[model samples]
Each structure stands twice: as structure tokens, then as C-alpha cells.
Target: MAGGLNLGNHDIGVLAETTVPGSVRPGETISERPVDITLTMPELLRESTVTLLGGQAAEGASTDAAITLTTGGQTSTVAIPNLSSPRTDIPQQAGSPWLIPATGTVPAITVPAYAADSVALGMPKDFSIDATIHTKTTTLPAELTCGGPESLDLGSIPVSGDPVTEPTTGPTTPPTDGPTTPPTDGPTAEPTDGPTAEPTAEPTDEPGTIPVELVGSDIVAPGDTLTFSFADEWIAKKVSFELRSKPIDLGTRTVSVSGEASVRIPTDAPEGSHTVRVLSSSGELIASVPIEIEAADASDVDDTDDDYWSDDVLASAGGPGAGIAVLGGVLLLAGVAVMTLRRRAGRS
Candidate 1:
């Protein structure tokens, strides 16, 4: 009966307690027996190559038994082997162990059933076992389903509630109301009257004798005192005084020998019928007068002051000095024909 089971770092003992003597004896005089013992430390004895188990020995009696181990302060012994009992009920080879390597001071095996059966068997009983090793977990690959062919033409794509057209052939329906009725055979008719026959009067070119006149045949409206006397045969030749109108030629002058000339009409000149030609010092086609030009009449100033005299001397003296008395009666009949030819040549 030794006692001390601390186990905080080892200290335990319960070395022996035997029973199994008469096997099931429940009578006569063995009333002080109580053998329900248990002790264990094997997780294979935390191996160093271990094996130890022992218990039945009674035939010749010396069946070995001892087990002690201490780690880190080194102490170890184990030898508990020997067993044989089970005559005809077969089930006994239970004692075989022997690991001994402790030389002198052994005392550290405390296996109060390896700490009460590893705390009632949840398992680690003093463990330090090792060897499951294994390793392989990596995986990842497999994925291919297979898809491709929809390159395009998704039903001509326009579908989001479609409706958008606007082209029924070129410039669409806007040209209908035309050609109302304007071709009744093109240029109708409504013009006829019969006598437009007076345009046949074309015999004009008759204007030559411009024997000069207009020293004032009537003018005044910002007037310019006119003059122009010609006709002694255009005053002996160096003549050049133009001023025609009927299709204008209005200017040119240079004829002087008392052929007395002048011209001024341009108070913006155009009052109508005008002509004044007389050209000749080689510019020939000599004469034209036709005057009219109206617009000015302060009582016409008596024909612009009788145009200053010589109407061919008042038509050969029908008025001014009677034209010198008809030129002295034609020189008195040329002296009475030279006195009758000198009396007929003195009667020859």
C-alpha cells in the first residue's frame, strides 16, 4: 500500500493489487476484497520501439514484472512478460514485453492509467507518437463547354419597336396638281383693225438750200443771240457751219466773210424740229434749214427782232430803200443803149 498520485509533472504509484484466486467465490470468508483496478500508459508506450504487458503467473511462480520510465532525466526499464492460464475456455496468451535501458536509479513511470486512462479515454495518454505524413492537395483545370457561330446577321437588326421608313421612289408624292388647262392651242387671238397703211411716206431727202437764216427766228429761254447770214454763194467758199438735227450733227463752224455766222441753241437744245446744214469747203452737200424749236414766247419778241434785216434786202426792195430804187433803174437802161449806138455809127 504505497500512496501519492500527483501527476503534475509526474509522481504516481499503484504497483500491485491481485485477485482471481478462487474465481467467483461469493461465500465462506473472504469479505474484505475489492479488486477493480486499472492502469495504462500505452499509446504504444510513447515508443522507442515499445511493448510491455504482464499479469498471469501461478504455476511455478516467477513471472517477471516491472516498468518505469522518466524522460529528459533519463531513466527507463520495462519487463513484464509471462502468462498462462485458461484450460478449456481458450483466450489467454496475454503477457509479453521487454524494453530495458536504465542502469541505476529508476523512478519516474507514473502511469496512473496514464493519467486516469488519458482522462477516461479521450486519448492522448502521454503521447508523442508521429507518422501520418501524407501531402497532395492541388487541383484546378477542366473547363470547355464549346461555343462559336453567330458572326452576324442577327435577323438584320432593327428591332426596338421598329417603324421608320421614308422613301417610296425618288422625290416622293408632292407633284400632283399641275397642268391646270393653259394650252388651248397656245397664243389665242384678238388683234385686227385694217388701216395702219400710212407708214408709206418715205420720200424724204429734200433739204439743200439752206441759204442761211436764223439770226433769230425766235429764241429766248436763257437765249444766246443767234446769227448766221450766208448765201452770197456761201460768201465765197471757206464755208463750214453745220448744226443739223433730224438725227443730230449739231456742230462745226468757220465761214465768215460777212457770211456772218453764229450759233448758240444749247439751252439744252432739244425742243423739236431742227436742221441747219450749209457745209461746203469740201464738206459739200451744201444746205438745210427747217427750224421749229418752240418753248419760249414772251410775246415772241416780234420774231426775235425781225432777224436783223436782209431778207434778201426785203425781197429785192419791196421795202428797204426799195432796194436802192431797183438798182437805179437798171442803170437807166444802160444809158439808153449808149445813146442809141452813137446815132447808128454817125450814119456810116
Candidate 2:
């Protein structure tokens, strides 16, 4: 169903699968197994006069089932050699009514037995089909809907065998055919789709040049550690970081093997319209990144000594507060003398 465009009769579906009994003994050789491989078509599929053909498999694999198709008139039989790489070639025939198995059903199937190492899995895990397959599947002269090939995915079911005896070692027998413990990362070893043709990163930039990434965020304040990721070509190379507005060397740093490094901005870095420059080998400028070194906020510096007046003038400067404190002290002494004079007059 993964590749179905549903162009043809959407109802025309085929669920071809095989079922096994509840138990299968591990590590045991089997006789010529008689398994029921069924092709369950939608009831509406019987309306179209097309024969559901059998299959052909890829090399190195053996899968077989006897398949019979009937249109309203004559009956024909075909063989699905291997369900592993299941494929069926439906030959075009003129004047033959589309077929369904007898009474719109498939008869029971008899499969060849497999030796210990060469058993066919009841459920074919890799049910793959390509577009060209539809040239045969839609061979019906009367049927029309999808004009293109649709890979008919007949879904899967379990296999039948002797119940496995309890195992002392690993799984008694490796599974015959199924997905691996962890599925492969890709269909093939290498990727067919290479790196993106164009990206904003280093690969798409100037040749011999690497990228400069601002770690965490682009916005930062003075005294904060600024992290950067650059091209691996500069790994282990020393680079000088400088404030770009009339350049001041922040410091020199060695790029890490991972093409990344960090430098802390100085507390005294100037506040202005700004950018930072990175110079390779500690001197010659290579690139500049715009930055804004903001001015210190009100709470950043201590103002506790504001009330002190002393020869350390920069710290304790002149203001109306000093004169105001002296004036208040004199007024307090005069008020106390006036109250004493009034009390002496009252006692006389």
C-alpha cells in the first residue's frame, strides 16, 4: 500500500499472504510443507474480468505456490515460484474473461519443504515491487482508472512449523528470512542522494573557507563567555579575537579539534556601534562578525560610598548633600539653646 496512487479501482485490492499453525520447533528439518497461500481480493474485484496471476522470484531464493485464475469462462493455472521477491507476469490474452479463483476464491496451496539452513519464511519481509509490474497486473482490456503502474503490495502473515523446544543457547535457529536485529540505515551501503547542492553553511560558501557559528546565541554581554564553531581546517590553529571598531585584541585562542572554541569578553570592552574580528595565526584578519557590547546597567557597579566626602575625590565628589547636612546640624544646636532660656525665665 506504500506506493499505491489509487488511480485504478481503489477497491481492487489484493492481500496475498500465508498463515502458519501456532507452533514451530526450532532447529528441526521440515517435510515438504503444505501451507495455504491466499490472495484475498475485495468483493468488488470479482466484478472486473481480470485474472489474478501467480508470481516469479529473484535468483538465489525459492518460493512457490500453485495459483489458478478464472474469468467467467475458461480456467488457467500459473506458478508463483518464490514469494520472497514475489513477482507475477500476467500474459495478455484476447477474448479471455477476467478471472477469479473458483467461486471467487483460491484453493489451498502445497509448498516444497526446506532443509535446515534453507527454509522459506512464511512471511516475506521485503515485499518490494516496482512500477513496471503494473503493465502485467492491469492487463485487463476492460479495466480503466489508473493509467500508470501500481506496485501491488500483497501484505504478510506468520509461518507454521513445530513449536520450538526451550533453548539453552541463543535463538535455536537464525530466522530464515526477515528483518535484521536492527534494520539497515539505508537501502544501500552508501547514500545515493549526496549532500545538499546548496546550503548556507561552509560547504556552499567560499572554497578553502569554513563557517563561524555563534554558540548558544548571537546576543551576548561583556564578561560573558562567547562560544564559536569554525571550520575544521583551523582546528589546533591559534586565532586572535579583536573588537572590530578600531580593533582591540580581546585574546588569542586555540581552535578545538571539533572546529569549535570559546572566548570570554573582557569587562572593560567598549560600548559602541561594534563588531568582532577573528584573525588567523594570531594576527592577519580573516572575518568580522557584528556585535553590540552594551553599556553597564545601573545595578552593575556599587554606589555605597556616595554619602562619603574625602580627599579620594573621584569616589566621594561634591554635591548639595554635604552643605545640606552641615546646615541641619547648626539649626539643631540653636533650637536647643532657645528652649533652655525659656525654661530659666519661667522658674524665676
Candidate 3:
């Protein structure tokens, strides 16, 4: 049986489940729907927990699950079993002889992407959590059930400002590699019949500045618009842009135009380095700007401290909340009264 954590006072839970049937053959996967949860003010959730209740597999078979969350253009994934350790939170008052057995845990999760969004908003947003279940081994099918009421801790929620992107004035300085001195008319003297030295052509560099400038947060979210500004001199010279080899036309621009263009990052764009190229009407390369899309930060997202489950915090939470247990292959359910408390902070 999976045990519940001691969350001081107020509590909110969303029932988690898979979209497909519970049973699956070896190497099979089951998809899940996103779970929406509402949290109140001052409820900082530093960690989250999910319980895996009913699941049976043939002898020697192995089962596993992964959790994925997408919020604010950032995605995170968590694998189960190997990644999560056992959690034992059975209380003392239950009885001298313990009855509740240990249940599988999915480990505690802390999505910084959603955490940042939550900090920005005064209310809740649609943070999506999806589960992917997998199993392998023995010939018999495996049964895995997603236990009810996934909980988020209000006491330790990590909060951060929402990501923002802003336009920037294009760089004023030209590339340093530009030819400083003009090519000279070399070998003025005429040579005889022998092979003569050829005058070498000096490389020329483009004179214009890169049209786009990234400002505000370099942390870009999906669908976030990046504003590109063309040099005032080139706005009317018929210039275009290309990102990831895809052409982007600025359309016909008037001399009085603002010289600013915007490109929205695709929601499905892969995380890594990308380049945007500025080109002239005759297919000449003008300038290129490099951008980096961060692979979501997953550090500490799975760090569940054993100290949080110590007798101190658990005692403050007034013992464990009600949980289910299995004995001798028989299902047993018990009810316990839980006291919840709420504290409010002054409005800013």
C-alpha cells in the first residue's frame, strides 16, 4: 500500500488514471490524460506524490511507468520503480500489530516550469500531467492501476516569475572581419611568357547588422514571439529571413515602416541550438544570429527528502491520512478522520 505524506492542514487532490484498459502484454504501453489541479494562495508545493495501488503481473515480470508534464513551453519526464524508492508512513495509533502493507510509490515530483507559472498568476492555470505505463517479461498480461487522488504539497511549492521575451535594438557595430583596406592593383609590371603571379581578390564582409536581437529572458517558451528589427537603411531594401532553413518573407515594406518583424517559436520545436539567417534580395547572406532552446531543467524535480517524512513533520500533520492495504491477496479498506488546517498571508 502506498502511504500519504504529511501536508500541514489544507489539502487538494486530483484523481489520476490512464486512458486505456488496465491490462497490457509485455512491452505494451498505456497512455493517460492530463490532470488539472487547483491550489490556493500561499500553498507552496515543493513536492508532489502519486500512488500506484492495484497492479498485478505474472511471476518474474517487471512493470514500470513514467510521468510527463508540459507547462510554459517546458517539458519534464519521470520514470518509476528504479527512480523511486519505497515510502513507509504507517502511523502508530492504528494498532500494536501493523496491518497496512507497503504500497508502490511514484516518487515526489517538482516541475519548475509549472512552478514558475504558478508564481506569476494569482490563481491557477491548466498544468498538464500525463502518465505513460510500460511492462515487460512473462507471457501473462500485467494489470496496473493508477491509484486515486494525486496530491501536491502546499507547504513547499517552488515559485518563480513567468518567462518573458522582449525586442531589442539591433547591434550597431559591424563585424570585425570586414576588410579595412581596399584591394590594391597588384603586379603592375607586365611579365614575359613565363606563368605570371595572379592578383588575389580580398574577401569582403557584409556591412549591415543582424536584424534580430534577443532580449528579456533568454528562456523562451513555446509560442513565444521573438521580435526582429531590420536596420533602418535596409528595411526598404527587400530583405528576408530564414530559421532552420525555412524561408520567412518580410513582405513589401514601405520607407516609413517600423522595420520590426516577429517570429513565433513553434510549440513542438526541439530543444537545442538554432540559427536564424538574414538574406538580401539576391540570395546573399547578410548576417546570422544563434539561439539556444533549453532542454527543460529537471534538477531537484525528483529530489524527495527523507527528512520531510520524518516523525516531526508527520507528527505536525497529525499522523497519516487514510490509506488502503492488501493482505493475503484480499483487499482491505479503512477510514480515518483527518484534521486539516489553513493559513492565509496578507495581500501584497
Q: Against the true structure, candidate 3 has what lDDT?
A: 0.34
lDDT of 2: 0.38
Candidates ranked by lDDT, best first?
2, 3, 1
lDDT-best of 2 and 3: 2
Off by over 4 Å in 1: 1-237, 240-260, 263-271, 283-292, 300-348
Pairs in steric clash, model 1: 40-113
TM-score of each: 0.17, 0.27, 0.22
lDDT (tens digit, per residue) of candidate 1 on 1-348: 001110111111111222312211111121222222112222222221111111111111111222233323343333222211111111123333211111111122222211210111011111100011111221111111011112211111011222233458677567768785766875586666876566657766766665767565643342344566776555423344444554544344433434655555554566766666667657876667666666766675455432423245447548656644433221100111101000011100
In order of TM-score, best first, we have 2, 3, 1
Report the C-alpha lDDT of model 2 over 1-348, residue by residue, as the tens digit.
Answer: 111111121222222333332322333322332222322222222222123211111111111223332322333343333332233322234432222221122333332222121222222211121111233223211111211114322221123565344468778887778565777677855565877565555554556655576667556666666777787666645577877677677765546445665666667777766777888873677677777777657576545543132224423434556433332221100111101000011100
Error of 2 at 17 (Å): 64
Measured on C-alpha atoms, candidate 1 has an lDDT of 0.31
Cα lDDT tens digits, model 3, 5-84, are 21112222322221222222222223422322221111111111111222121111112234444445555554333222
Pairs that clash in candidate 3: 1-102, 1-103, 2-103, 9-341, 44-156, 44-157, 45-156, 45-157, 46-156, 46-157
Best model number under lDDT = 2
Candidate 2 Cα errors over 4 Å, as ranges: 1-209, 297-348
